[model samples]
Target: MIAHPNGTISTEVSDFLLNCLVRSSSWNFWLSLFLSFLFLLAMGANGVLLVTIWLEVSLHEPMYYLLSILSLLDIVVCLTVIPKVLAIFWFDFKSISFYACFLQMYIMNCFLAMESCTFMVMAYDRYVAICHPLRYPSVITDQFVAKAAVFILARNGILTVPIPILSSRLHYCGKNVIENCICASMSVSKLSCDDITINRLYQFAV
Candidate 1:
């Protein structure tokens, strides 16, 4: 339940309305179709790349392994934000449940961070392979790749957990309309009546 700024305790808010950028009815229709098509194309390409990498034994090296992880992360990111965005654009289905919103926010933050970390690890792998050719085989082993994957998961998963938890704890006494495509941490935090200084700073830190 949200306690209004005027001291009235309102019923628990089950969902939040997402105020998507819909300029006009016709615009929304065309935009949604285009976005949906793009999403499908992206997913299909990534899926094929993943399958090919899995099937071909020659592509089972550290570079291709990291590329596969990147593809998986891309697929996850697209799935996390694009479906709801398409629904909002097409049917004006903007209402997202409170817990669902938090879940989406957490996933977006964590996955993006993990993706960035993956890129860094990939860069380091390339650097070692090129800068020190002889030692590359020993340095960039399958065990090293496995450890990198685990570190990426652990670092992002644990660090980004607090973002949603902190936002969920805020007293959202004001309007519940989020003016964005996704349930971003700052977007949700700004709707709260309580102090959001910590939320902002923590998000910046992350």
Candidate 2:
């Protein structure tokens, strides 16, 4: 996939993730079952980890606290797309409504971006604590961490709103059927019959 200076294209990351989400029919029903089972196992493990961390006072340190947050985000990410993805694979939902697609796209992007920012903040925390132990307490306070988490969520959340708003406003003239498994920005953009020259230019610029 191509990379840019500021950020990589959404489709590139989504494409890669979708590939991991899907499996070939050659893998057989049993293998698919086993893989799904394993996914369920991991989800259960994370749930247990969250409960243990929450219920046990000893597990409430900064590192574990961040880990708990990460685990919760992980579960949200999986829940966001996996069900629709599995439905597409097992059942039949060839066409998703524009509204549903937009909602999914925005939400998936918001949570994913939030997780990325959270990881970056966690890295900075580790660096401060390990590299400058004496000053770590002053540098990373409880309020500071709370604000950091809110900043990550708010930053990602605000950026996602425009994507859906822009996409939903477009009028699809021709074949509404999406070429890909999921409703991607490019796929949706390509379906629009209205003047999209500006949109295309902006997309390329991004």
- Single out the weakest 10-residue window by summed lDDT for candidate 2: 10-19
Q: For candidate 1, which ten residues in a row score worst on lDDT? A: 5-14
Local accuracy of candidate 1 as per-residue lDDT tens digits, 1-206: 66666788866556799987777989888888899899999899999999999999999998899999999999999999999999898778999999999999999999999999999999999999889999999999989999999999999999999999999998775688999889999998998878999999999999
Which residue pairs come into collision in candidate 1?
A: none
* Model 1 error, position 72 (Å): 0.9
TM-score against native, each model: 0.94, 0.77
lDDT of 2 by residue, 1-206 (tens): 43445674322212111222334665535554765786698699899999999999987777777777788888887776666655655654445655678777777767777888889888999999989999988888777778888888788888667765776676654556566555666766666645766655544543
Clashes found in each candidate (C-alpha, N, C closer than 3 A)? 0, 0
Q: Any runs in candidate 2 off by more than 4 Å, and if so which?
A: 1-35, 195-206
C-alpha positional error of residue 114 in candidate 2 after TM-score superposition, expressed in Å: 0.2
Best by TM-score: 1
RMSD of each: 1.6, 9.1
Estimate candidate 2's RMSD in Å. 9.1
